[model samples]
Target: MSHISTINPATETTLETYTLMSMQAATDKVEACHDAFLKWRLKTHDERANYLKRIADGLRDRAEDIALLMTKETGKLLQDGKMEVELCAQILEYTAKNGPSILADEERAHSAGSKKGWVTYSPIGVIYSIQPWNFPLYQPIRVLASNLMAGNGVILKHASICTGSGLLLQEICNDAGLPENLFQVLVIDHDISDKIIEHERVRAVTMTGSDTAGRHIGHVAAKALKKTVLELGSNDAFLVLEDADIELAVKTCVEGRLFNNGETCVSAKRFVITDKVYDAFKEAFVKQMQAIKMGSPENEETQLGPLSSKDQFETVSEQVSKSVEAGAKLLCGGNPTDQTGYYYPATVLENCLPGTPAYDDEIFGPVASLIRAKDDEDAMRIANDSRYGLGGGIFSQDEDKAFRLARDHFDTGMVRINSFGAADPNMPFGGVKDSGYGREHGGFGMKEFVNAKAIYLP
Candidate 1:
């Protein structure tokens, strides 16, 4: 057994130690999960839902403690972390309430008065879920709730920075009476992630991480002929039309870019504003970005927290530096804090060129890049130019035009009109292009862990 050390991203101090699972041990655990799936998946949907409900209850009861641990581990605001925990519970409850119906048999009529045909949703055996640290609780919950309620076992390989959150999730499942090995956390090194993916027991894999990691995992899963879902990177564009409510657009842009200190995969990374509203939007946006508090995530008054790790901080910093060198003006913030941890101030860049590093790169920190456009057509062109097509937002007072732009032009899998992009329990969430290939959260999320089998009567 290898020992895993947990560190606080805020202080760069050791927080806890855990026994990391070896490759052989991980294989054993996966085998156990496969065995448990045999029994667990055989249970009635209602029975499985009861287990999910118990997990939700546990999460709700310990929301505060879980939130604090999330903040300490991932360097997100305590309030945001608390919201993440609550959202996790909500996801579990939503899955428990809706999974049965979504997975129920669908009946279809025969063509010439023949027998009726039906399609059934069945469990897909063991799943390997690779989650990131940004939304530590919510990201894993999005996979775990849907899979468990759909009668599949999950083996989570969460980011090293958020191991505490992963362990807590395991504890919650065990405490909620989930059978042994039904849901396990593998505290293994990143180098061995591919080895764990190659386990024969894993039928499918899901990941929410960088594009590079997604490509590597997708390759491994493809070689094994297993199904894979990748929620990769995003350079989501936030477009502001000339007719948009300037205040609303600015507010949404600021909130979207700075939320989670701009560590979110779907956060608005690029701003494409029409020439008419460009100057006004920038002025208001810069002010809001500057007003946001930057301090410890635990403080109630704090709105921004440290980046999750030193590597992430440095990468984002380097990207900003290159963007400036490439001719973008630093409107507000462009420097990291001198204090401990990976803290960086909320930053905004203007006049960023299309091909610059900041323009195309996904900066996973509190930084926003602005791009000017001549009109809606130019805005659409700018938005669709990137390789990423995750979540995007379009702001305009003309509902018809906004709707048309969202339906016809936005390259992302999800688009929000006049509001910041978000995922709800009822709606589907995923992305197109290099952003990834799988859907998580909502009805689609449940189906990702299940196999749809067609049954026909002869």
Candidate 2:
């Protein structure tokens, strides 16, 4: 009978505790979800869509409570928590509205004659999702909403730190008329998680976490011959061309780096700027990063909150130190306060070298790395010089040129022009290389785990 403590990152206090589920219980729950999926899969697309709409409604109805719970569980701003709920609701509604068509059988013309062929998307059973703590609601909802709409049951093995948020979501879905066990939350350890992934009833697995974890899970699932969709680590490079608007680049880059307390996988971690505007952009960016207020997440005036956990704080702090030791100059905020909470000030690093963690690794905190590019060509080159490619952005006045660069040159899976955002329900998200594979959102998620059967008429 093991247990996990949910500690509030901002206060370093225990918020709640959850008992670990035994192996037998976990097995039973998987069986239950599989049973539910059999019934759920028999429902028509429109019938399933109704449940999704109600889930969206339920989220809106409990938005305030949900936001507060999320903020307490993960030290994100209250405003951001509320926004996460809204985003979850949007995902639900979007999936409900577009899922039917996206998963509908497509009619195709085959051969040289007028013979017709078709491809039908069929629902798979339970999809086991392993999500991280950042954006507790949005991360799980990103997968759950789309999968549910696709007529698959889901089992969530959320980050231990955000267990409460995970269970709350399950309660909301059930309250909204989701069939019992269609969405279940498993409070289990890594051992149980591995076992669950290998469970026969679990049709597919999806994960959002570090590259290391992604590799391990991908390997295990692969060994079991199970399909996986992994959205892993990233050191997203935001390029500022010489022709870029300094004001816009500075503002957007700061928001991109510090959003979600700088815990996002798609956050702008590296700033690759052309020499012509390097100094100007660096100065303005450092000023904004330095000015961020570090206080209670509940305070509207506070711009930066504590790291999600003490371990995260230590990781960011150590990375900054090693980078500085390896010749990276600390432009600002190298020291974290000896405070009660796991607070690390917004930091900016310059003279980032290739071998150092500051330049190579993803600094998952309020730290920004500035890289001076020889020119616009070099900026784009530097942006692609990484093993990871989750998301990146370009800041330039030339919208058409930026679009071409993003479409043709950016090596990442998702890109932004002149602005920054984690995700959009209407656009495909996920990445390549060490960032892992598969796409989510924009109706693409609806087809990830489903079978695309080819029906050919000769």
On lDDT, the candidate that comes out on top is 2
> Candidate 2 residues 57-169, lDDT tens each?
99999999998888888899999998999998999889888988888889998887589999988888999999999989999999998888788999999999999999999
Quote the positional error of residue 117 for candidate 1 in Å: 2.7
Q: Would you give me the overall lDDT of model 2?
A: 0.92
What is the TM-score (0 to 1) of candidate 2?
0.98
TM-score of 1: 0.97
All candidates: CA RMSD (Å): 1.4, 1.2
Clashes (backbone N, CA, C under 3 Å), per candidate, total 0, 0
Instruction: Tell me how many residue pairs clash in candidate 2.
Output: 0
Q: How would you encode candidate 1's per-residue C-alpha lDDT over 151-207 as one tens digit per residue? A: 899999998878989999899889999999999898998767788788888999999
Q: Model-by-model lDDT, in order? A: 0.88, 0.92
Listed in order, each prediction's TM-score against the native is 0.97, 0.98
